[model samples]
Target: MTTLSHSPRHGPTRAVLRLHRVPLWVWTVLVIAGAGGLTWLYALGQEAASYGACGGTGMPECATEMRYWGSEHQSAKLLAWLPCGIAACAGAVLTGRELEHGTATLAWTQSVSPARWLAAKLAVPVVALLGGTTALTLMFRWVWGAGPDGGVNRWNSEYFHAAGSVGPAYVLLGLALGAPAALLTRRTLPAMGLALAGIGLAYHLGDRFRSSLWPASEVRGPWDSALNHVDQLEFGMIMESGERVSGLDCSDQAAPGDLGTCLSDHGAVDFYARIHPTSHYWPIQLVETGIALALAAAAVAAAFWVLRRRLP
Candidate 1:
């Protein structure tokens, strides 16, 4: 009898691909949509700029201005939320459903081994997720930086993570997180919900404390139009006595002539603020990306641990 090969070298990987075809397609569409959307918006940016910069103009005169901001906002939201969305799907459909339906168990019995099964399950998606998000991040980064005065604020919560290396890290975190969630819950819907909630909370907390990831630059002087463009974390008056106070009570309510006296009464001698300049963009992105990757690694480890315990 002719000898028949018993084991397929790529069996597990093939099974993962066959089972997760939907997510694969969804991811493919998302990559295309994100790149295409950013491309279209970049083109729109050029058109919007041709309107000749409507500073201080009213609504009607600022149509192009409004359109540009609108496009940017839409783009920002899409880029920002897409990772969390994928994480949820990964948790629910990719991992959770597989375990819930006992397919993982079936695979293990078919000589796949629990570890190799999980590897195939995770590795394929992780590679695709990282590659796709990285490509999108680079595309959007270009869109943000290429045009004159068209760049998104590097410090903006919505745009900051989306336009940098952190974007792919976030996607990887979502994928990694989904693994433990699915392994633990072993149910599709609950795992999806939990994974999404975890990712969303982590994202929000990261945003809330982003300014503190690195030391902020301090600027002290009279408040002027120039300071308006900064990403201010804190701003107030510095008292003559070397005390700082918030500006809640130091506004237009004070009589124009008494403003100096009012500020003086509050012991204000100068204005100071903690801010992040565009120069710090890369540092913040890198630090946060490291944290995201760390979390992702931890999640993947936990997933493997859970799988081993469950299987053995």
Candidate 2:
């Protein structure tokens, strides 16, 4: 009896490796085919023939407009979304399939800590997500090219775009959100459905948040100021204060207003600024990312805690 009680520590890790195999291949194909193709299309379809102040003659107008107002940022936005999309489908398939096919019980019996087991399952798709997203970012930088002064802003740069766009957060959120439903529903199709639905809902919510980030434009005085929507999360302040209307806050300036929230026509601007609460765009990205990822971690923890205690 004592001899028969074998503690096989690597069993769960091996099982996880097996599950990850297919996902790895799938991501490879996607990077080569999907990512590659999209990049080509983006490059080809850029504003080459259209907006050329130089008459599309002297220095390649396509690359010209791309220097300042290129669709590179837009391309990055679309590419960044892939990991989140992959995570949703992968999360649904990850262990949901196991539970559906009645293979989870067998998996659970293997000699492995519950923590390790769950972690192993989580790591594979996450790696794929990180790799694909990183590649797309690099490609975005390359194709978009750097203009005079390198034309690199936090909003457009790989680093800032990664943070601001909330791609990683999206993946984590999907994982967190899908896991609980998977546990409760215990079927691949239903779990997948719930995950997809949840992601769709998150999209709408995020869109609203994105739109709200840029405080409305103000037609104060002679300046018909137009804040670049692309730089919504970048510029510290769009407009300087002292007029009847306001745009954003400035750390360097502003004499300071009341301590608490006050409805000051432009009162909404103050409220929006206060709620946004980012000294700069970078901080806003950081806070948003932190909150999203933190929520995802909490969700995962709750799922495992509940499952472990309730089941065994």
Candidate 3:
């Protein structure tokens, strides 16, 4: 007698997907919006590039081009934060609701073990989070270029989190943080609020320590030099005795000849700045990504521990 087996390998996963289809749809919309935003930015960039018809640097047409590009670039920047927003929504809206509404326990009674159920729930969102964030990261990198251009500095706080693997890493952390938050709170609104607060705190810490992750390049020069202005972490004056003092009052109102004497009186030999150049973008991104991933892993571990402790 031949026995027919009807068990499905992805029953739990399918259930998870079916239950959270709304978030999946939202995620899809975000990905599409991100791609569309990049495409729009690319077109704007092309138009701005075209207006560079003049041969010189200070032309009126070139100024107008930069102004237009700046406006569009600022608008496009909002797209970079989309991944984090999606992660928050997924955590709060999808996972939290299941725990809050007792659906998780209900599923377990139907032969879906709590562990498998949680695994399915987390796995589906994670896969979606990774794919969505990665696509957006690659697209943003392409649109924004590998390094700083015009006004988009890779080292800029917002762009640093948005540009590469760092953005996705933070989203992953959010995804991980959400699960634990939901499990802990067991309420939709509270879980979401907790998750967002956690993510925000992580962002703040990441920003605070970003500079220490990599050594900044120090260049000695006049403050007015164009090269020293971009991605500068610290600006100061170098004293003759080699003491670097920050917060020099170098303003346009300073008399031309008096400026030099003032600087000398303030023990400054030359203007100096600590900066991260375009070359440091990847190194910074990779290091920060590692930190974010570590946090995510910890959060996931904590979530499972919480689940095991709370449920049979």
Error of 3 at 108 (Å): 1.7
What RMSD, rounded to one decimal, does every model reach? 2.8, 9.1, 3.3
Cα lDDT tens digits for candidate 3, 1-312: 999865766889888788778878877887887788777776666666666554567886676567655754564456446567668657766667877777778888988787787778789988998997788767766766621246544566676766678888989898888888888888888888888888889888888888888889987766564663257778878888888888775775366677787787787778878887777778888998999999999998998899899995
Candidate 1 on 1-312: residue-level lDDT in tens? Answer: 798774766898888888779878988998898888889878766766666666666754377657767777777777888865786567556778878987777777887788887888888988888888778778877776654364345677778767888777887888787888888899988888778888888899889988889899988765565665567888888877788776534566345566677666776776778888777878888999999999988988999899888874
- TM-score to native of every candidate shown: 0.89, 0.65, 0.86
Model 1 regions lying over 4 Å from their true place: 1-7, 55-61, 147-152, 248-250, 253-262
Q: Which order, best to worst by TM-score?
A: 1, 3, 2
**In terms of TM-score, how similar is model 2 to the real structure?**
0.65
Q: What is the lDDT of candidate 2?
A: 0.58
Top-TM-score structure, candidate number:
1
Top lDDT prediction, candidate number? 1
Better of 1 and 2 by TM-score: 1
